[model samples]
Target chain A: MTGVIVTTINLTAIYALVALGISLTWSGLGFLNLSTGAMYAGAAYGAWLVATNISSNVVVVLLGGVIVGAALGALICLTVFLPLDGKPNWELRTLTATLALSFVGTNIYLWQFGPQFKQFDPLFDFIREFRIGETLVQPSKTGTVIATGILIAIILAFISYSRIGLGVRALTQSVEGAALVGINRRTTAFAILGVSGAFIGLAAVLLGQIYFVEPNSGYSPMIKGLIVALLGGLGSLRGAVIAAFLVAFAEAVTLQYLGGSWVLITLFVLIAVVLIIRPRGIAGVLEGTRA
Target chain B: MPRGREDLLHYAGLAALFVLALAVPFAFGTLSILGSMGVFLLLLSWSISWRRQGGDTLAGVRDRSAWLFWGMAGVIAILIPIIAGTSYFLAVMVTFLIYLSWNVMWGLVLGTAGLQSFATVAVAGISAYVAGYLSVELGKSGNLACVGGGERILGVPVFQWWVAIPVAVLVGLIVGFIISLPAIRLRGIYFALLTIGLVELARAYVVQDKCNFGGGQGLYGASSFIPESIAGDLAGYQLAYVAAAGLAALALIIYWRVNYGRLGLLLRTARESEPVAEVLGTDIVRARLWVFLISSAVLGGAGGFYIAYYGSISPSFFNFSTVLFLFSMIMIGGINSPRGILVGTMLLMYVDKRFVDVDPPEARYVFIGLLLFVVTIVARDGLISIPDQIRRRRGVQGRGTNPEGDPPEDVGAIEQEAHMPPGSRPEPS
Candidate 1:
């Protein structure tokens, strides 16, 4: 049970990181971009690209993901929407176009690198065991999850309260209104996409450490991140975090009881059911925040 | 010729070239590369017209020009292979006629209803798997050969192909309806995403379980529709061309019926603004259901023809690339125009095949990437609508309007500078 819980927490932390980026894109950008996987894959590929240079520093590996992800995110948004400017169909077009680009990115990477799975470092070295009653269990990944979860919370809170945060909120509500207030829409949008992209890139690096990285690697988890964003309601950061844990835990438990292959099947089913039952997601849209 | 008249003449001349296209098998005198193209053009015409029929006010006999053009072209296509003695092309052309019927149905749903679907791929895939499995088990042998390769599905008796098409369509409709039940709740990205889930599920169930091996190498010759030796050979080309032509014609008519028909326009209203359409008293749910079912039935029929054309079907071909590419074909052609879309596929495939010639198979990615880049830059509205876009820009005609109002409409207005998702506010409370 403890082992399962630890795995759940670990996976949830990764989901939280990925979902936060997805939430930002959905809530802030008015996009349902499913290309987070491409960004995440970029990081893993970045690490693989410079594996000899970076060696094994966990921070370095993640930074590789972050920098590449942010760059790609900015590139995608600017390139995708600029051409589609003013078209009310921008949202759907953006989603479809981005998806195509993502495929291109994935295939490009695959063609250049060739198809192979690479193993990265696992953060934890030792597993510790403890028992409450008669049940025996070992807890691994406890530290990684705890430490990262705290960092994400702090960073998110800081953004929420800061002056820059205020400007971001304005843009989210109304680009014209923000411009009316002299928030500099162009600079601000660029800044936000860049920062948000990099942040998710870091999340991808963290995920790569736990799972095997390949072209299709980020897709399964990216789907989860999108679900968490939707389930938690668009733009709800806390909701995404919580939903991440819920999904991760449910998935881990399901895998523990049923088998490994069933985890994805379960998540897909879960999202379908949840979305049908609650279209607005579990978090509900924030009233105070700019929609 | 006057420039405008010349342009119309070019269209008419190209439109009239269906006679030449039909005669292709005979002209080429071989089931070589050109004959293969003949087969492809016919199937593409199916989906292309369905897309064209979208957002139109008329659907039936009233919208006769496009239908008439398609029919004339299709008849011309049929005669070419017959005159050229290209039985292979004729046979392939025959299968595509069946495909055209199905693809038009999908186009009606997709073009008319405001739905972004990926499940149609899965629906067709499932149909193919079913037909293949039944055909193979019943006694068909040669299942591993790639398309156009000189191979035959030896064991299965020929009669089954006759039964497979309708069965495949029925299965497609049933699946489409089932998917829409949950699918209706999803809007925008969520609905498209759900289809991906279904696709993966199909892959896992069909391919991995090996009951169908539905996940991996799709299906091999389950039924003996045509012999490969004759189809791939020079003499076989005419047969394939004629068959492809007939199917294209049949599909054009059905698609025209739905798209230019009353139901298709109702679908258009729903897609353009479902809520507004509902406010205006259109049964939004019913429209969604109707269009989706139409698409599935069409897709299923296509799937049956799909088996006949390829002599095999595999899950690998049905993966994300297939979905993305087909969607790209739709976008590159123009969302609601069938004529443009079919033409788009021909252009894209031709360009794609060119890349295959120049690059190592793996490096073909670079060419497609570059081509996609160019297309996105030059034809953001797709190739078919380029003139319309230019006219709109020049104010010669101000027809295509952006539905969403807030953001700047001209993509050119936004600078090519990297930025956040515009919504990435710090205080996304």
Candidate 2:
């Protein structure tokens, strides 16, 4: 039972980190950003390269992931968003374009890194494991959960209180209204992309410690983030965080009882049911307003 | 010019195009790339010239030209096997025709009806599995002898290629109808996501059902559709090519009928604005459902043909990448035009086939991605509109002769005219 709880919490933390980024971009910028998964994979590879080739320092590796993630985020913004700005069907165009980028990004990784899965041994070796009531636990998992909690809290506080966050909120509410109020759409959009990318990078580094990083590793997490974002309501940060935990718990319990394959089947079925019942998602508002 | 002379010129142009198309394979020899390019260029030039000769608003003339184009293209397709005279070249043609059929079906639902369905591969997979399972089951029965003097109707052989095709198509229509039931409630991206879910569920079901569906390793050795006498020869390719071309031609006709017919206009209107269509008393739900059903049946039939042509069915072939490829093909070709769909499929499939042989496999995705990106940004209507874009640009630069290049006070007039019926002038109030 304790193992299940720990796993659920750890998974929830990771999903929260990724889902937060997806929510921010979707709600704030009206961009689905399907390449978030690619960003995650890219960051994992970036951190892995740093740890394996340069130094085994955790900070350096994480810094590499952040830099890569930010760079990719900026690149997507410039190429997809900037070029097609002010178009009639900008949202759908960007969505498809990002999807294309996601495909290309995964293939690029496969071409450059070969097909073999790589591990971040340095990070794994550094983390210490402890036992609690006959259950063995890795501090790294607990550390990740705690760190994610802190980061999410910081993000929540920033979004709630900061000036830039206010600008993002305004933009999310209404693009025209935001423009009328003199908010710089370009700067806010870029900032959101940067911050979301960094969050994905951080999540990637932590996830790489637990799983093997490969060309296709980003696909599942991308799907998960998409489901969580939609379930939580696009652009709803609070709903995203809560939905992450809910999904993580369901996944953990399903894995514990049914087996591995049933986990995805059950999760997807659950999402379908939820979508049928609530098309706007758990916290989604009516059509006009962004969550 | 007189009407007779104008009509003569049109027929002459079409005849020249047909002759050029027939000569392409012979001129280029066994290399399919050059042959494909020559044919594509010939078609492109023909279409461009046809568009430039735009004075014929008479529906009869338009219909005749359309038929002429298709008829000549059909003749050229039939001549490909004889002119190319190689199994490799014929195989490439077969692949192009199959993709052409697939994309046209996709264009019906996605392009004309404006539904963002990603379940083309899933529907195809379902049909393929049905065909494969039936073939295998019937083949097994055909190998068995009846015991104890009992008539064994259940154990009788029914795995003929001809039998499998109709049964698979029927199964496809039923499955298509069933899937579209729930899909009618969903809209846009939500509907797209639902299809994705359906695909995942189908894949998982196929992968897990080891007893009936052959699980992951996949069932093999289904009897080939090609006859035993010419199974390994160029005749087999020719047979497959003919079947594929026939299917593609049928799909194109359906697409054309839908686009030009009343049902197509209703679907398009629904796509543009569902609320407005609803206000006009159009059965939006029924229209979407019918289009979905037709598209699904077409996709399912294509899948059946694929299994027949390839002699096997597997889950991996119908995965996410397949969906992406189909989606990108429609986008690249111009979703609105059947001709664009054909051009897009041929262009991308040719490039992809060559890349598989020459370049690193990963480069294909990058190339496709770049194409999608460039096409989405540069030619929103796809490569089909590129000629018009070029014309507009040249006109803008040269003499500003085209009013479309820079409409000063005509914006409001254009907007107002868009809502009015064609050939109906506004009342002078």
Candidate 3:
């Protein structure tokens, strides 16, 4: 039971890492970035490239994810967003464009990395055997959960407090005001998109180690992240993180108790019921997004 | 302002095209003439409706004015096959008519109202499941129960022929109203997401019960509820289809007529500024509901017709991608344009269906994503609008006007007032 609990925590934390990044981009850019799925699959492949062909240092693999993901994210923002200049129909354009790009990215990665699954090593097995009163827990996944959640929360708080964070908030408020206040809209928007992409990359690397890395690995997480954000409240940073772990934990529990297919139907129903009742989400935006 | 020879020529062109549509099956032996015609008519109708609305025009169309000439040319081109002894092509024309039936309603809800939705396909899916289930249950007993009513279903005889269509239509109204209840609260894409969620929900619901709807396993043989003995043979069903289509099309024309004048202006204005419409004594909610309910009836009517043709149902038929396709149909054809809806569906659906090699079902998704991407970028208004663009360019050239000079002066001033300098203003690249 303890071992299973550890794995669940690890999975939930890993999901939060990806969901946090996705929610930030959505709040800033005003659409779910479908490309994160591709970037994730790319990261797993990237890890494989380093692990097999070069040095497999844990830090090195993660850095590879960040580099590849950031470059791709930056490139897409320039190509798709800048040219369009953030058109009014962000929901449609971003969804459609990123969706197409995801396909191309997936195909290219599939060709490069091949279609089968590949295994990679985790940072460490820290949940081995810990005695607490009358019980001892030995699970490799427990450490991952505690460590990942702490790391993500810290990163998010740091960014939110930073000057760039202030600029992002201002940009979201009124694009014109931000520029007038001497915030570089282009650079600022790029930073938000990039940082979000980087987080997704990190999550991808983590997932690759925990599970089998395949071409289609990112889609489930990507979709889960989107639902988490929406379920929490679109554009709420903290809500997405909290919702992420909640949903992950729910899925884990459902899988443990019920069946896999039932989880989707149940989650979908829960979301529909909530959204219909309160469009703002579980916690209203004003409550969640405070200065 | 005036209907002239050009307008006459346009209708004549439609007739000629209709005739040619009847003739095409003989020309291409492999082609299902009705399917081809259904697709073609869909495009034609889309073109007609979209052009009337001030929908988006890209690739230099920028709102071309000469709709009559294009309409006429379309007919003249189609007339050749009909004149060449291919009246049999009319059989294929019915298929295209069916497309128009559904899409027109979709244009009303999605296009005219500016209420973004993605649930029509799902509604169609639910109705399809309802339709197939009813037809199949009636069929299983080998009873002519579907043909009228010897067998009473809850003290009401099972409807056959035209009755089934209405039953389906009523169900559509129910589904539409159910979806509308949710749509009232949600904004644009949120409404769309809700629709998708409902569709998934419907998919789940449809797959569960064996008595009402055949599960994912699919419905077995279904009878065409149309009374063939009275109509004659297969050609008899054609008459019913055309008659039904004629009525539906006439209904659409009436819809268009209502929309063309003061009432339409009221709705259009309402879409841009609801408060203004409210100030002007328009019951915004009632007017919206009016259009919504009317559109639902038509959508339901279309679903009835589709079941008449397919004679089967499976939950698999309706999904997210179908919604995407419907969106593309309107977007590619023209927004808020009835004719454009028809033309766009035919042109895009045909091209997509033909060119797309969907050997694997998964590949179909990637194919559609790519298609939507390309079309969204190249012609956001849809393919039926292509001719309009060409015509506009021709007019611009006729005037000998020099294009591409000034950045609209008002844009800069507006940006400046918003506290963003012109340089820092959004790049209109």
Q: What is the DockQ of each candidate?
A: 0.28, 0.49, 0.24
Q: Per-residue alpha-carbon lDDT of model 2 for A168-206, expressed as tens digits? A: 889878888899999998888887887788789878888
DockQ for model 2? 0.49
How well is each residue in B31-123 modelled by candidate 1, as lDDT tens digits? Answer: 433334433444334333333432221212233345554563455454445453544445444543443444445455554454777786789
Q: Report the TM-score for the A-chain of model 3.
A: 0.86
Better candidate number, 2 or 3, judged by TM-score: 2
lDDT agreement with native, every candidate: 0.62, 0.73, 0.61
Q: Which CAPRI quality tier does the interface of model 2 achieve?
A: medium
Greater TM-score among 1 and 2 belongs to: 2
lDDT per residue for candidate 3 within B268-330, as digits (tens), equals: 656655665565555656666666776776777677767766566667766544565666666
DockQ comparison, 1 vs 3, better candidate: 1
Q: How many backbone clashes does candidate 3 have?
A: 29
Per prediction, the TM-score for chain B is 0.70, 0.79, 0.66
Top model by lDDT, which number? Answer: 2
> Candidate 1: lDDT over CA atoms?
0.62
For model 3, the superposed segments whose C-alpha errors exceed 4 Å read: A1-11, A32-68, A86-147, A150-166, A202-223, A249-258, A284-291, B1-100, B138-163, B208-212, B226-267, B356-371, B378-429
How big is the positional error of residue B241 in model 1, measured in Å on the Cα after superposition? 4.4
Interface RMSD score of candidate 2: 2.8
What is the C-alpha local distance difference test score of candidate 3? 0.61
lDDT of 3 by residue, A1-291 (tens): 543455456667777777777777766666667677887888777767777777776667767876666676787677566654533334555665676667666756666666788888655553466764554544435445655665567566757798887888887666667878999877877887777777787788777776788877887677666667677876776677677767777777777777665666676766677778887776436422421
Stretches of candidate 1 exceeding 4 Å from the true structure: A122-140, A143-147, A173-180, A286-291, B1-106, B137-159, B212-218, B227-241, B373-380, B396-429
Instruction: Please state the error at residue B137 of candidate 2 in Å.
Output: 2.4
